[model samples]
Target: MHIVITGANRGIGKTLAGRYRAQGHDVTGTARDGSAEVVLDVTDTGHHADMAAQLGDQPVDLLICNAGVYLDKAERIDGYPAEMWAQTFAANVTGVFLTVQSLLPNLRASQGKIAILSSQMASHTRAPGGSYIYRASKAAALNLGRNLAADLRGDGIAVGIYHPGWVQTDMGGAAAAITVDEAADGLVDRFAALSLDTSGCFETYEGQPHDY
Candidate 1:
């Protein structure tokens, strides 16, 4: 499959890129800087245009919106700054939208799938009160993916939102549950299982149904 992943310089995104490539799938991985085959800073609309130009009508089978930020890791109520909220939303929410929007034509041509890497924190049932920005951003992403699924179903494009399982990555830290490869592998399987019938699903890395 011809796949595109964002924020692939390290962590789960990086691992997924390598695994997919090793399995003989064509993978275009992007980073904020010029560090991959596609130097796509997801929030940058110009970069999205550049990426589309680079692909130049190449059909994409799968697009993984994996680029995100967790800036409000442990912010107090008064400590949550305004700029922090803006930056976090830009990377986590708007970035996903831009990538998907820029690649719509290619996805439509291929009848493809989109996998949004959201978090368990995105769920309203799991609100623990900390990391307000990250939680809110992820929730917005989940909402975005669901609505996109509804709108794009007629175009034969499927969209799914997933929690990558609190992986042991730079963002997840050392004490997290799973390794990047494990999470990536599970997510790859999840992506493969995505379809028009199951579009807008919110699932875990292991394929379990998640409450939204």
Candidate 2:
């Protein structure tokens, strides 16, 4: 499994990178800080393309768009900073959209799988909004995954969206139910077990599907 992951310098993405590397798979991770195998600021569509080119002609087997943002204490929809909302969408939604869409040719050649990191907050099932920006961004990402699944099905490429659960990362906070290691490991296991027939499902790291 040659995997390319975003936001791999810390949290769940970092954990996933380490796990894959330990399992002897070729893993390329991207971070804006350039600390990972590749530097990728996913908001910059051109940079995403450049990173793909940097990997040469080899097809990436699995691409994980795991970078995201959380509004923290400044959570509000009515009067939140528009810049923050834009930035959040840049990393959370547009970044994932562009990266996956731009890399479709390579993915098609490999018949690869793409996993977009979404959140339970994306769930319209339980929507009420304190973390307005975070929720909206993730919701948009979920829809992005759905659209990609539909678009790429003919290419034999599988697309999925997943929530990492409330993991104990900086974004998830200390009281979150799982650890980064736990969440990453669970997601990897679930990824390996997914069938093409079930590709578009939005699932948790634990493999239970969530309602869109």
Candidate 3:
């Protein structure tokens, strides 16, 4: 299997890359600084094109859009800045779309699975105070994944949105609920179970259904 993961130099994405590689899968880890096999800044359109060019006709069995930002993680109600919102959406929402679109050909060749790493916070039913920008951007990602699932079903590509548990990573913080390895292991199963019939589902890393 050929797996491509974005924002993979650190955090959950990094762990996923390592685990997949260990499993003997051809894993490509992308980072913004050209420090990875694929240097892709998800927010940059040009980088997406470059990535496609780099891969050429290689088959992509799985595309994980794990690149995201949480700029307003601790911002209070009145503290959310306009620029922060735009930056967050650019990375968390627009970036995911661009990656999927740019890699469409590769995915089509392999009938790949797309995993959008949305968050439990993306759910309207789990609304907690703070992290306004992160929450909204992730919600948009979930919406995008759901619609893409519908549109890509005919192409044999499955798209699923997921809330990787609160993991102990730089983004999740040390006090988070689960370790990076734990989340990655569970998510691997979730990704493996993805198919046309289960596309568009909002699921947790542990296989539980998440409320939209």
Candidate 4:
């Protein structure tokens, strides 16, 4: 698979990139730091379109909208500044939407899959308070995934929204349970097994589908 992955400098995204590349798949990994295998920013909408053009028709088979930020360093929901919510959404929802939209043509051409990196926190049925910014952004991302599934159905592109569990990464923190490697592997396995009938469902890191 020729895949485009965002947030590839660290955590699950980085680990997934390594795994796919090791399997001899062509991978384009993007991060804020240019040190990524391919330097790209999901937040930069213009750059997304440019990269799609530059790819020159060698369309990516999978588009992983994985770039996001957590405002753990800031105040919690009850007393947090409203600006943080905007900033979080800018990077999470808005950035994700732009990245997916920009690469949509390629995905259509390949009859590919779009996997959105959402979180368990986004599940409304299981919602709680706190981490307001993260929760809201992820919720929007989940909805976006649903919308994309509907919009891309004609192109035979499947959309998946998955929660990678609480992996021990920069965002997930050091005390989290799973490792990036384990989460990435499971997600890849789950993704490979999904079909259009299963698109737009919520899935766990271990490949278990979660009902929304």
Query: In the order shown, what is each candidate's alpha-carbon RMSD?
Result: 0.7, 1.3, 0.7, 1.5
Residue-level lDDT of model 1, residues 1-212, one tens digit each, is 89999998899899999999999999999998778889988878999999999999999999999999998887888898999999999999999999999999999999999999999999999987889999999999999999999999999999999999999998999999999989999999999999999999999999999999
Q: Candidate 4, which ten residues in sequence have the lowest lDDT sum?
A: 71-80
lDDT string for model 4 (88-138, tens) is 898999998888777877887889998999999888876656777788889
lDDT of 2 by residue, 26-121 (tens): 998999988988878989977887887888777888998898778644654466788988998988999998888777777877999999889999
Deviation in angstroms for 63 in model 1?
0.1
Counted clashes in each candidate structure: 0, 0, 0, 0
Tens digits of per-residue lDDT for model 3, 40-152: 98889999999999999999999999988888878887899899988999999999999999999999999999999999999999986778888889989999999999999
* TM, every model: 0.98, 0.95, 0.98, 0.94
lDDT against the true structure, per candidate, is 0.94, 0.87, 0.94, 0.84
Q: List the residue pairs that clash in candidate 2.
A: none
Candidate 1 lDDT at 1 equals 89
TM-score of candidate 2 to 2 decimals:
0.95
User: How many clashes does the backbone of model 3 have?
Assistant: 0
